[model samples]
Target: MISFLRKIRQKLLSQNRVTQYLAYAIGEIFLVVIGILIALQINTWNQQRIENNEELEILLGLKDEFENNLEELNFSITINTKVTEACVQLTQLIRSNSIANDSDLLDDLLVRIGTFNSFDAQTGVSSEIVNSGKLTLLKNDALRTRIINWLTLLIDQEEDILFRSDNYTMNMMPFLMKHFPLANGELTKKLPFDKKKYLQNYQEKSPFKFNIAKEEYLEFENQIWHHKHNNDYVSINELNLKDFLKITLQMIEEELNKKK
Candidate 1:
């Protein structure tokens, strides 16, 4: 192609057609420029297609992670509700002078005391995307903003859970162990209890005998207060998780549809 154009230019020059040769040269340059632009456009299209596929994979991974997170949040919410209810019942009994000789109630209350959910969401893929500067590939401005907000809230939730866990493990449990006997403390640290045997024998074999004292009841009241405080935080985080998960899932669906 270059040789043919050069020959044409030489022939035009030999004929001394200066005006015609200049016009022909300009047209040839324009065609070359157009070809380069077309090649560049094709390259840009291919690169965009690769990026789109990668974004879809990231979005699908996020969907799976958040779905699992939703399940965990639901479970935590249920446990928090149960713990809150148990704390309320115990507090009411103490306030009403109805706690005397309520060994059965005490046993039940103890069982519900430290059953906290300490779950962490799977954010490996999301974190990698954000930290590696791939977040811009999301394309949708709204979705990007939502994802950032969700990650921020997740950090907040994790901090709250840590605070609650510290309260339960360091303050609450130590107080309980000091005052009352727990038969299954060792068993609980490892795995699920052998339910039938545990329920039947826990009270009898407990190191500290059943004793209802004013000081013990007061300590339990303090424990209940801490539990209630943590319960409220759990409820707040559960709602946050639900809302974030719902919005992200919708955005993911939209992106998937666009991909198809």
Candidate 2:
């Protein structure tokens, strides 16, 4: 192409038709400019295509990560709800004075903890996402924002669990211990700490805190263990715990729904 242009330039200089030469020079200049522009446009197009592909891949990866996260969050919520139910039931049983001795109540309380352990199982959504190194792969800004918000809320819930666990245990446990019986053999697990231990170890800011409400209910939980010490037999408060369990299940549902 350069050779062709050179030949044209040579012709324009030698030809007698100088007006025609000027027109031809202008046309050649326009053609060269257009070619450059075309090349630049093609380069831009290729770059944009690559970027779009990368963005799409990120979106898909983010979708998968969030979906799994959502499921786990929902599961945690289910467990929390069940634990809550245990609290409510234990409260009713204790407040209603349904048990003649504290031993049966203690068993119910222990069982409640067992239920809590099952429901309040440890979860690692943030860890999983962070470890997966997939958050870096997220391309959609909107999706990323949503994920961040969801994670923030989960953190808040965890914080709430930390906040309420201590004092609730301190305030409630000693009160339950007065009625709790012991050495009945009907209850299996022993109440390791007496009521005062709650206040002694009470912490609103402990990094080691479990759900305070969980332990709060556990203070009365020893009542069943007490009854077991005395050879009395009875059912724990399983039915009453269901309402909290139901709440937990709802949380799971809400977490799942968040993905949509």
Candidate 3:
């Protein structure tokens, strides 16, 4: 093709039809420019196609990750609710000075309050996308924004969980250890391996049993009250994260559908 074009240019110049030659030269230049532009346009379209496919894959991955996270979040919420309820029941019993009647129930409530629950989100897809600067590949502005917000919410939720954990570890556990036998609470827990059997094997029984005095009940109640509020904060944050996950998943679904 180059040789043919060169031959045409040589023939034009040999004829010395200067006006015609100049016109042919201009036309040839215009065709070369047009060809280059067409090639560039084709390359642009190919690049866009590759990006669209990549974005679709990212959306699919995000959908799966967020769905799993939603399930885990719901489980955490349920556990948090149980913890809150246990706190409330214990508070009622302490306030009424009726806790002395049911040692077993008190033990069960104590076990529940002592158990810690936190939402463990699957952040693999989202974190990689954000950290690797691939979030922008998600062309939908709203979806991109939601994904960023989801990461922010995850951080906020983690902070709330840490606060709750600190309260449980620092305030509640110390108080309980001082006043009550931890084995009593452990007996209430249902583990895969029989905890009661394990304790019996070890011949471990606290000689000092849990005996809450009327005056001490107020102090214990204060601990439960604060722990209840901590649980509440965690629950609220989990709920918000759940909402964000649902919205993000829905947006991902929409984007995936567009591909179909």
**Candidate 3 lDDT tens digits, 119-222:** 87888999999999999899999999988888888888889899989988998888888877777765557532243555432234456778667788778989
RMSD to truth, every model? 3.4, 12.7, 2.9
Structure candidate 3, residue pairs in collision: none
The clash tally of candidate 1 reads 0
TM per candidate comes to: 0.87, 0.55, 0.91
Q: lDDT of all the models against the reference?
A: 0.78, 0.47, 0.84
* Residues 78-163 of candidate 2: C-alpha lDDT, one tens digit per residue: 54454465555665665655444554454545444433321132235434544667554444444445545555544544444443
- Which clashing pairs does model 1 show? none
**Best lDDT among the predictions, by candidate number:** 3
User: Which number leads on TM-score?
Assistant: 3
| Higher-ranked by lDDT: 2 or 3 | 3
lDDT of 1 by residue, 25-137 (tens): 99999999999999999999999999998899889888888888888777777777777887888788777776556755665677676666665777888788889888999
Error of 1 at 40 (Å): 1.4
Q: Comparing 1 and 2 by TM-score, which wins? A: 1
